[model samples]
Target: MELDHLLRDAVRRLADAGIPSPRADAELLASWVLGLSRGELALKALTGLEVSGADAERISDLVAERCRRVPLQHLTGSAPFRSLELRVGPGVFIPRPETESVVEAVLGQLRRLGEEGIRRPRIVDLGTGSGAIAAAVAAEFPAAEVHAVELSAEAVAWARMNFEVLPDHAAQVTLHHGDLRRSPELLGELSGTFDVVVSNPPYIPADMVPTEVEVREHDPQMALYGGGEGGLELPFAVVAAAEELLRPGGWFIMEHAELQAGPIAEHCAAQPLLESVHTHRDLTGRDRATSAVLARAQRGDVAKWRA
Candidate 1:
């Protein structure tokens, strides 16, 4: 019943259950239970300390949930995004490391604009699942006005929880509940107002969703399956919305399925209001994010014609 033995057993069980990074996950759980850092856990492991009965029970329950395909982030109620640890749960999408590049791309674009004497840019995160992108943008650019939109009521609640726990800068983030493609009132509020628009929308083809155990079993389906053909409807909607939401010379960036980069670029090209459509690869060298500048004067032209 020693801590090291318990951790070893937990790791073995997780591995047997087909969980990736079993040892690392076990270590993280152990550290959380013991209220120690991972390095501290290593040192304490050598001492052969016994876990309290209550702590052992808690870890056992967590392990059982993991075996049931529940995400560790959900079990722990938190996920790390950029430098922030945001609360997560059943209704929210767990933030992934790959999406960090999306945040970086937004920040880089902001920095470039800053060099041109633009500061305190207004930014929006469409379909902001866990509010990861919005929160990160607020933290990185304290002066910016950040807003996030989510269609799911549960997701909006989870995002609001994350927003509450953030630092003072998080106060800058405004959360709206409604679909970007359909909510006219919500759309009107942001019409021609943002300097940057970013999103990590659901892009997995509807049929392909069932094949990924981690996604199908643990993540919310509404946050994953785009539609049939997976041709970038969500990202396209964000692009079209951005045409109305972003100021001329503003930028829109989106994280998408790596294989859909060409189609995403093509979609942006068709927008006519978006120029310089470009794809950015993730750390693993997969095309993961795309960005384009809004044609400034044309936004008004497009909006007026649509009106």
Candidate 2:
């Protein structure tokens, strides 16, 4: 069958199965089978290029899996976040575009710190998942020291794969297999010294079942739930970890569900060590992240916070 015709059939199958962005997914799967870029696929389709039977069969099988609600990224085994393409699979949470804005917030603060003459800012990503945020920061700002902590061994393995493949970009990213809350222990010497701390912790309420099948079934629960009935416990824990890790006046940013914006902002505002509490919206203009600056600690305050 011709490439365009095969793609049309795949799109219909995916759409009938309720897969969003059917045409795009079909094209991407086709490109994967043909080992061609989307542009090249388009050119092939435009010129009436015929797909070999073996390759067309492969595309059909992939489309079937996608139609069964398998995540597109899982099928492709990769997800793009900011400037980094991360390896993603069943054990790892796929990085979403919204989290890119969370990275942007961190980068903005890092840039300002550079302007203020802090050349080598210490940065950490709590619950780093695929190490997307840490790798992106290290890739973009070579001077910054980046660290990532993951609680799940499975997630850590996947993160390590990404770190290894992107050696130049992830060279500065130190991956720690431990809970973010134990920064004082896992990253003991760096406690109260990070210039920026960021995370995309699980914020989905336990009872709030995700509407999409891909998320509802495939993503790891440990990377989806934030604990407690409202799912804010882990996010708040991220806040406490940031307080422990960040230097006085350092920045902390985190991603959460859209409905979490107000509560998270309020939570940050109430913290004695955090100020400049604000909510940042993603490209869709929905509240996606919250940011705050650690209140500069006085001599006694630092000791107390550390304790």
Worst 10 residues of 1 by lDDT: 206-215
Task: Compute each candidate's TM-score over C-alphas.
Answer: 0.94, 0.96
Q: Candidate 1: where is the Cα deviation over 4 Å?
A: 169-171, 187-189, 298-300, 303-307
Tens digits of lDDT, candidate 2, 1-307: 9999999999999999988799999999999889999999999999999999999999999999999999999999989888877899998899888888888878888899999999999999999888889888887888888899999999999988887766564557789999887877999888878999999999899899889999989999999999985899999999999988888888989999989998999999988888999888899999989899998877377778657
TM-score, cand. 2 vs. native: 0.96
Q: Highest TM-score: which candidate?
A: 2
Clashes of each: 1, 0
TM-score of 1: 0.94
Error of 2 at 20 (Å): 1.6
Please tell me which predicted candidate would have the highest lDDT against the true structure.
2
Candidate 2, which ten residues in sequence have the lowest lDDT sum? 164-173
Q: Evaluate model 1: give its lDDT.
A: 0.84
Error of 2 at 258 (Å): 1.8
